[model samples]
Target chain A: EDQVTQSPEALRLQEGESSSLNCSYTVSGLRGLFWYRQDPGKGPEFLFTLYSAGEEKEKERLKATLTKKESFLHITAPKPEDSATYLCAVQEAKSSYKLIFGSGTRLLVRP
Target chain B: SAVISQKPSRDICQRGTSLTIQCQVDSQVTMMFWYRQQPGQSLTLIATANQGSEATYESGFVIDKFPISRPNLTFSTLTVSNMSPEDSSIYLCSVEDTREQYFGPGTRLTVT
Candidate 1:
């Protein structure tokens, strides 16, 4: 079975604090790993797509790195605006583009 | 990225009533999907709306309970039939562009 798990279900960080959220997956064949940020009362916004191990992507204060069995979303000097539920999903190589998502990690950056 | 929009951002309906949600994408897309997000839960795909064909429902989901219609490449609708309190959730529409998927604002439904 394909499954995705995210650790540290909830995190409270002071403004300018740095932390990393973890996503571990067990899939038949890894096709793609995606990260999304969802705010209250809004839908998810795309963040990054990591396709292979050792791949990394960054945007402003956020950086995402991938490994064979897991992925990490690192937030550097996060601000209050960066507070949101971060979601992780994985696509199986043999499946028809369907995504299996994790429970998500809620981060609160207090100012 | 494709921009998606859903109608009725939030609604409160009584049990036994039905509600239909519409989804429109900025550009034509080959694949569209409907998902349900329960409070504090991750998104679960309800069905895949294929243009000019019957929608493909996921396991544990049926067409009679949640009917989907894909009239064209950029528009689709999902109707939640015989609503119940357990059906209260955020319904989202997503479109696949190339290798990535983009979601709409979502419809927040509250059933009484």
Candidate 2:
């Protein structure tokens, strides 16, 4: 069965603190890994997509790296505005355009 | 990225009633997806709506309980039948644009 597990259910960091969230996935065949940020009472916003091992993508203050079995979302000098639930999902190579999502990590950057 | 919008951002309905949520995209898309996000849980794909075809529902979901309609390439609707406390969730619609899916604001439903 394909499954996704995210570590550190919740994290509280002071402003400017940097950390990384982990997403471990088990799939029949890896196709793509995605990262999204969701705010309270809102829908998820697309962040990045990593397709192969050693692939990395970065935004303003966020960086996502992918490997054979897992992915990591690293936040650098996170501000309060960046506080949101970070979600990770994976697509199986053999399946159609469907995504299996993780429980997500609730991040709070306190000012 | 496609710009998506959902109607009736939030609503409170009585049990056994029904609610229909609408999703519209700025551009034409071949595939539109509906997802359910329970409180504190991850998003789960309910069904995939394709233009000119029956919606493909995922396992643990049924067409009778959750019917979907794809009238055109840019619009779709998901109706929650027989609402219950378990049906209280955030319903989101997304469009596939070049391997990336963009989501709408979502409709928050509360069943009482």
Candidate 3:
């Protein structure tokens, strides 16, 4: 069965702190790995998509790196406004666009 | 790139009642998807709505329980039947273009 596991169910970091969230997945083959940020009482916002092993993508303060079996989302100098639940999902080789998501890591940044 | 919008941002309904959530995209999209996000949980795909075909439901979801309609390439609706406390969740609609997807704001449903 294809499954996704995310570590550190909840995380707290002070403003300007940097950390990384991990997502390990078990599947036949990883077609694509996605990262999304979701705010409370709203929908998920798109972040980045990594397609192959050794691939990495970055946005202002967020960087996502992928490997054969796991992906990491690294936050650099995160601010309180960047606090939200970060979700990691993967698309299996057989499925075209359907996604299997991890439970997600809730991050809180205090100022 | 697409901008998806959903209607009835939030609602409170009595048990056994039904509610319909609508999704609209600015540009025509090839596929639209409906998802359910329970409190503190990851998004669960409910169904995939195509332009001129029956919606394909995922495991644990049924057509009778959750009806979906895609009359055009840019619009769709998902109706939750027989609401229960478990049905209290945020329903989101997403549109796909190639590989990237854009999501709507979502509709918050509370069953009491």
Candidate 4:
């Protein structure tokens, strides 16, 4: 069975505080890992895609790094505007484009 | 990236009724998918809307309950049938572009 798990179900950080969210997976074969940010009552917005171990991608104040069994989304000096539920999903290599998603980590950056 | 939009951003429906959500993309896409997010739950794949063919539903989902239609490469519709309180959720549509998926604003449904 392919599964994705994200830790720290909820986090409250002060504005300008940096933090990291974790996503661990168990799959027969890894194809890709994805990160998304979803605001209240809205669909997810794509943030980054990590395909292989040791790979990393960054956008503005967010950086995502991947490993063989997990991925990390590091937020540097996060702002209140960046507060949202961060989602993690994985694609199995043998399966179609289906994505198995984690429960998500809800972050609140208080000003 | 592709820009996607959905109609009826939010709605409240009585139990046993039905509702249809529409998704439109800015450009033609080969793969379009529908997802459901139950209250406080992660997103789950409902089906893949294939153009000119019957949709491919994921496990735990059925066409009879959730019918999908893809009339063209850039448009799709998903209908929730025989709705109940348990069916209240956020329905989202996404398109695959350049090996990445882009999502629409989503339709928030509340069943009474």
Candidate 5:
């Protein structure tokens, strides 16, 4: 069975604090790993997609790195606006455009 | 990136009533999906809306309970039938383009 697990169910960080959220997965064949940020009462917003084990992607204050068994979303000097639930999902190579999502890590960056 | 929009941002319905949510994408997408999120829970895919064909439902979801319609490439609808308090959730629609998926704002449904 393909499964995705995200650790640190909830995190409270002061403004400008740096932190990393973890996502571990078990799948038949890894096709793609996705990162999304969802605000309260809204749907998720697309962040990054990592396809290979050694791949990494970055935005302004966010960086995502991938490994064979896990993935990390590193937040640098996060602001209160960065507070949101971060979601991780994986696509199985054998599946047809379907994503298996993790429980997600709720982040709060207090100012 | 594609921009997706959903109608009826939020609604409160009585038990046994039904509600339909609409999703519209800015551009034509090859794949579209519907998902449900309970309070503080992660997303659960309900079905894949395929244009010109019947929607493919997930394991726990059924066509009779959640009917989906994909009449074109950029628009789709998801109807929650026989609503109950358990059906209160945020329903989201996503479009897959290339290898990335973009989501809409979502419809917040409150069943009472």
Candidate 6:
């Protein structure tokens, strides 16, 4: 069974505060890991796709890093607009692109 | 990347009724998928919408309850039959071009 767990279900950070959200996964075979941002009542928007361990990607103030057993989404000096539910998903190597997603970490950036 | 458009952004339906959600992609796609998300929960895959074959449903989901149709490479529809309060959720349509998948805006369903 493939499972994904995220830490800090909810976090409230003041503006310019930095924090990192964790996504720990256990799968039969690792293919790829994905990160997304979803707003209220909307579907997830694509973020970064991590293919292998020790890989990192960044966009603006958001940076994502991948490890052997987990992935981290780091928010550096986040703005109010960056507040949303950040989701982590893992796709198994043998499966046909079906993703198992984490419960997600809700980030609230207060300005 | 594919751009997916889902119709009827939301709806309020009575119990035992049915609702069909449509997804149209801007370009050709090899695979289409449906997902369900309950309030404050993670997304669960419902089925794979194959163009020329019957859909493959995930565990706990059946074709009798949720039927899917993929008429072509860029279009598909998912119908939720015999709606209930438990069925009220966010239904999302996704298309996979290669290794990555893109999602629709989502349909928010509220069953009474």
For candidate 2, give the lDDT. 0.95
Distance (Å) between predicted and true CA of B1, model 6?
2.6
lDDT of 2 by residue, A53-102 (tens): 99999999999999999999999999999999999999899976899999
lDDT of each: 0.95, 0.95, 0.92, 0.95, 0.95, 0.94
- Over B65-92, each residue of candidate 1 has an lDDT whose tens digit, in order, gives 9999999999999999999999999999
TM-score of 1: 0.98
Error of model 6, residue B59, in angstroms? 0.4
> Which candidate do you rate higher for DockQ, 2 or 6?
2
| Worst-scoring 10-residue span by lDDT in model 6 chain B | B94-103
lDDT of 6 by residue, B10-63 (tens): 999999999999999999887999999998898999999998999999999999
Q: lDDT score, residue B71, model 3?
A: 96
Cα lDDT tens digits, model 4, B36-62, are 999999999999999999999999999
Candidate 1 ranges beyond 4 A from true positions:
none
For model 3 the local lDDT of residue B98 reads 67
Model 4 misses residue A5 by how many Å?
0.4
lDDT of 3 at B57: 94
What would the per-residue lDDT of candidate 5 be over residues A1-111, giving only the tens digit for each residue?
A: 889999999999999999999999999899999999998888899999999999999999999999999999999999999999999999999985889999999999999
lDDT of 6 by residue, A1-111 (tens): 789999989999999999999999998888999999999999899888899999999999999999999999999999999999999999999885899999999999999
Report, for candidate 1, the interface RMSD.
Answer: 0.6
Clash-forming residue pairs, model 3? none
Candidate 5 has a TM-score of 0.98
Which is the leading candidate under DockQ?
A: 2
Whichever of 4 and 6 has more DockQ, that candidate is 4
Alpha-carbon runs more than 4 Å astray in model 4:
none
For A10-57, candidate 3 gives per-residue lDDT tens digits of 999999999999999998988899999998888889999999999999
